[model samples]
Target: MRSLLSRRFRATRAVTAATAVLALASVTGQVAHADTPAVPEFDDGFGLSQVTEDREVHSSTDFSITVTTPEVAGQHKIRIFLPSDYASEPGKRWPVTYFLHGGPGNPDEAGTVEALRSDQMITVAPDGGRKGWYADWLMQDTAEGAANWETFHLEQVVPLIDANLRTIPDRGQRAVVGLSMGGFGSMHYAQTRPDLFGHVASMSGGIDFGNYAVRGAVVATELNLTTAWCAVSSSRGCADYGPVVDSDAIFGSPYPVFNADHIWRSVNPAASANLAKLADTGITLYTGDNDLVENHTADGVDIVTSRLDKLGIPSRAVNYGDGSSLSPTCNGGHNYGCWAPAFADYIPRLEAAFAAEETK
Candidate 1:
């Protein structure tokens, strides 16, 4: 259901050469990718049923894999940056890190990939698709290139990696981190499936999708922008994993009348069953002092930390304030300037978590 806002948004966007390339790209948007399948296909639940693309990079193995899966409108993609000695050390099994990118992910996320690849673990980046919301659609689009992102990542992608790669393949052996939309995805996925990830971090993620300072600000505005793209700058350009859809397609209608179920609330970190699982997991929250979304991004971090106060589950809360040596954001808007440092701040923590699991 492309609305007037969508049409207007598409018409007014600044699609740069790199961004035009992004529109039909992978989850990271760093490499060239395959077109989404016309009809959806299911995986066997064991591993990748079919692989359409695979290529290599330098000392570390950087490859993008396109696989057939019923969860998405087209083939889901996986971008892997393997350890430098991944080829030489066949016998050694390594821990894995899952990186979730933002709505339109940082264009040059190569640093993060390189860091993970060289850091002593394998890096796994899965395609979240355009405006996928990192959640399965509440109502199916039933159109070409529709997406079932939740099933695609948790059901299809996770097993696909473990089955094929030499991963420790356990809860403590794996970590998940994301930027912005991915921040939401990382936390949501970590909470929803407590068995899968040992460590979770969100970089400038508007995590309080349910109610931060004001209710529904995340899904209604930020998440909504990803769907219709009403306010994206040409510099940012769209990053494509699949077709862009409206917020309704992912959660529910943007307007309040349609969200009586509080789908957003259900997914919030403060909700049910959270008392136990999250207490066992290491959680990190990051947000720049000045975010483009009126700094509400910080509100979610505050809310989650405050709510979890009794449990003492959250390990770290890093707010790169207006005057900090680490990711100093002197009141500037949301940009990559902060993410790189935030990512750097989290890498060691991820390594520490992975190391802890190795001992047990």
Candidate 2:
């Protein structure tokens, strides 16, 4: 497998350029149809048939749900894969893994499909609201843009998936994983609400918002004029959408600071003291050494892991072998390619986490 770093760098460069163009056009009042599919829909063994209770279970049919939250409204097209024995053992609850997507996009990539199959766990990939940070942002036009993804995941998606599918609703049986932005979201959500998830993983995730703010600003500048960048300040009319308070607090500040600390403290998990709370739960952190893009950095993971260590929190961090930067492939990088295989490797560990929760 190509190292996570190489994949992240390549993917980030591609996404950055693409996002810049989109943001510039949007800011210029160039409204485009939002109905276009963000990613191509394809099956990677997720739709295969299975046998249960001596009966064949067809995988052609999967659930597609639309979860509308106050902050943001979007669809969660899910592919529910029951274990081979699920049909035979009716009413048995199984662990669920909420897989997330990178950037402001869909999780229908090839690698993601493969991960769903290899994990054989009930996988849920909801569209992570507008801007794709999976968090509320400062831009008002994108006000509804900042989907309360955290709330949606815990309150809406989890319960709905559990109720509608054959999933173990207990917190212990639940987990989340993602790559790039999705990776950041997984760890952020897990750290913020440890009571809800047992195991969390990120593959070449962009976990540090402090770093992202600078990169995002740079990308915004490159994509559009300075006026477009300035417009982001007013959420109501701004075309460039992103977190509002980052640049003011981190990069420049002349007068005595008020609330700047709190603003900075809130978004960066590395700055939060509550991160230790996740230790009582469990965390699986992984990134590639060469991932030196906007958010995918060894330094980012190192920052979080170091904090966890300080709090005596038990966690696992892995760095894949060395390789040049590559886009997420079917087999490697932060995209579905690498995520699918990694998911397979983590299945037993996730099952054990669920089992441990059961005993408790």
Instruction: Give residue 294's error in model 2 in angstroms.
Output: 8.2
Give the range of the ten consecutive residues with the poorest summed lDDT in model 1.
33-42
Pairing residues by index, what is the TM-score of model 2? 0.65
The whole-model C-alpha lDDT of candidate 2 against the native structure comes to 0.54
**What is the per-residue lDDT of model 1 for residues 1-360, given as tens digits with 9 covering 90 to 100?**
346686564434323322343344444444432232111112334434455333332223666656667667665566777776776676999888888877554322544434555448888887775456688778675443546788888887887778667889898988888876778888889988889987898876757755534334334433444433322211254433334344455565544455654676677665644534687888898876654452666777777788777666656887776525674533434555666666776787788778877897
Q: Which ranges in model 2 have alpha carbons more than 4 Å from their true place?
A: 1-62, 67-70, 74-76, 110-113, 118-120, 143-146, 212-258, 294-296, 323-334
- Positional deviation of residue 80's Cα in model 2 after best superposition, in angstroms: 3.3
1-360 per-residue lDDT for model 2 (tens digits): 235686575456445544553332433355323232122122112112112112211242233433334545433444345555654565676788887765434544422355365334566676663244655443334324434556666666666666546777666788888766677778778877787787888766666655655345433432333443232211133344334433332222222267544543565656547576686666886665632242345667788788888888877876653422232442222334445555666667777777778878
**Which 10-residue window of candidate 2 scores lowest in summed lDDT?**
47-56
Would you give me the overall lDDT of model 1?
Answer: 0.63
Q: What lDDT score belongs to each candidate, Candidate 1 first?
A: 0.63, 0.54
